[model samples]
Target chain A: MDAMQIANSIPMWVACGIPVCLIIFQSLLFMSKARQASKDIGLSDDTVKKAIRASAITSIGPSLVILSGMLSLLVTVGGPVGWMRLSLIGSVMFEGIAAGIGTQQVGVTLGADPMTPTALAMAVWTMVLCSIGWVIFATFSASRMEKIQHKITGGSTKRMGIISGAAIVACFSSFVASHLIKANADVGFYFSKNAVAAILGALFMFIMMKISAKHKKLSEWNLTIAMVAAMILTAILPIGA
Target chain B: MNKEQKTEYFENTYMPKMHRYGKLIGVIGVLVSFIPPIVLAVVFKAIPDWGKLPAAFLTGAAAFGFLWIMEPIGYFNILGPVGTYMAFLSGNISNMRVPCSSMAQVSAGVEPGTEEGSLIATIGMAVSVLINVTILTIGVILGTVVLSKLPAGVVGALNYLLPALFGALLMQFGIKDIKYAIGMLLYCCVLYVLIYLGVFSWLPSAANWLPIITAVFGGIAFKLIVDSKKDKAAAAAEKKDE
Candidate 1:
């Protein structure tokens, strides 16, 4: 059979489905524990429900974005693998890059050359191997991080909060900064629609937060509104161009 | 809850159970991740050249190895332990999981880095994983027909989804402390520029991680310095009163 046929075969679907199933199982398990803990901590059931609602709402746009990217993966790697990988432990960006690198190892570029079964094997191997590092690191080190945070903050909850807040701000700032600046061989550095999207997103979110403070009901939709507004403006305007 | 109850919940119930189950699931996840490739080899008779496997793995490692270690450590504070397990296993950490976690915390009015925050983050991440997987499944089954009909403009805008999410999240966190927000944003932008200009040539793949490391630790250091200075001033005022 050809690579595509093998990639979408029944066995392949069953094989890939295992991890996806595992992911769901793990999420459900952890979520149940968290629910119990939430009750123990005296958080009202309404708060938990609100969090679920907000998170579910916040997830749709990005998941749709991943769906679009999955189309490219579907063409390159076939449906089952693409569906499984993206549904489980891989992002659109990482999976594509890893697959390309894998195919290249066999002297074949992913989109440019005909895919052989050998290339498919290499691609799957590379994707899996590359991601293993995260699981391994987390398995060993996750439990230790709280101790590290404690040491850093000298066991003060307030100080820990400051450090955590600083870290999150730093992390997101780095992400935004990367999006805002683009380098071209000819242009040196220039902002693109991506930059506009980011800036507008921040601005819209700021406004939403201000308004939500008074309205309260608006808080649940703040992220969704900000993101949609920014995306629409960035798409329609030529500002950063 | 009272202090004693909170401590009991975290110490006796939450942390231990999460650690044990999380590690088990993680190990199983690693083992199961290899099944697809193994099946391809065994069932389809499509085995790669064993000799070239290392080179291919190295290529991916070279690109992503730093993220494997750094992402877990860097995202831990915000995600906490339970959220970390769910986030890594579910992927799309930055774009999907983190944003959902943050939104949940905000909507629930829970402070980040606290036990309540951790539970809320977990609920958020779990919901996102379920929702994300459901959407992905539907998209995979029906997307080819529907997506082909989407306008080019709409498709093009999809590219901005992540940047916009990051931007919104930055605002969400930034409002908590405007000074740190501004300072860290400037710090990251400057570091990103330096990396882009190849100023950090001696560092391997500095672009992937340098900005993140510096920004996270640098922000902490800056906050510490400012806090100590404030403490000093307060101490002087108290001494004068005495």
Candidate 2:
């Protein structure tokens, strides 16, 4: 069968469900363990509940944004593959590029024609194989990281926390700095919408934080608020072209 | 039991169960992850072109291979083992999981790496997975027609959203530790400027990695420097007391 036919096939959908179920099952087990651990550690139930609520609330906006990306993937790879990949190991950005590169290698443009089963196979292979690095590293080395970190910090969780926070800062600074590099090269008022958007996002984040202090519920929505405001700013601003 | 012994027991007894279950399910996930491709190839006799496979794999890997290695090492401290496993498996680590986990930690008033913080982060990540799956599933069921109808300008702006989000996230982190934040920002600026000035242009690949190296290692170095100063001060105080 062709890509479209296979994608819509009941068997493919069922196959997709396997990974989804595994993820859900694993998540549920972990959550329960964490919840029990929380209680054993004398954590107030209210704090745990607030975490669950805030996390869920914060995820909605980003998830919608991801939904748009998933829709685009569906246009190229069809429903089952797109759904499963997005639902499991891949994200909005990763799978599309992987599929595009896979199709390009075989001299077929994704979404340009009906993908033969072979073409579909290529996409699947690329997506699955490309993503294995994350799984492989995590599987073998994940547990070891705690030990390594403990050794590095000389058993100080506080120092480990600082190192972790610093890592995040550094990682994000690099990403933010890349935009500045792009903007620097452009030599225009706002040639890089990314830079503008990033600055605006920071602005919005500050505003949200300021407001959330008084309002409280807004804190839960800080990410969503900043992101949406920045999205609008990027749309209206004369940049990113 | 003392707090240390309790923590040890939790790590020894409870953590092993997490590892067993996580590894078991993770192995199954790895195995099942390949089913779609294998079945597609076997059932349809549509194995990919052997000649094209290497190029295709390399092309895909080239873009993401670094992230696969770096992300786990980078995020492990905050996300911990369970969060690490789930985040990598479910994907969208930087954009979705980190924010949710961090926010959860903040809202719950816990520092990451402690037992309470780790638990909260895990719960937050799991909830995010559920929410992410739910929303994406609905979008899938709704089909592309309605989704594609979203205004061009609005969709165009989505590209900037993640970049912007990252910038905001830096601020969130910066507030907690201004010294490290400033140090990291400076380190990134220096590296990026160096790359732009063509210092690393001789080795183009070096430019690609310099920012992250600056971020991870540079930040660590700054932390060490700051910590040493604090240690010195404490030691001097103790000496004075003596």
Name the runs in model 1 displaced over 4 angstroms. Answer: B228-242
Q: Which lDDT value does model 2 have at B192?
A: 74
The complex in candidate 2 yields a DockQ of 0.66
After superposition, which runs of candidate 2 have C-alpha atoms over 4 Å from their true positions?
A183-190, B193-210
In model 1, how large is the Cα lDDT of residue B171?
96
Which model scores highest in lDDT? Answer: 1
- Candidate 1 local lDDT, residue A80: 84
Instruction: DockQ for every model, please.
Output: 0.80, 0.66
Error of 1 at A165 (Å): 1.2
TM-score of each: 0.96, 0.92
Each prediction's whole-model lDDT (CA)? 0.87, 0.79
TM-score of chain A of 2: 0.90
Judged by lDDT against the true structure, how good is candidate 1? 0.87
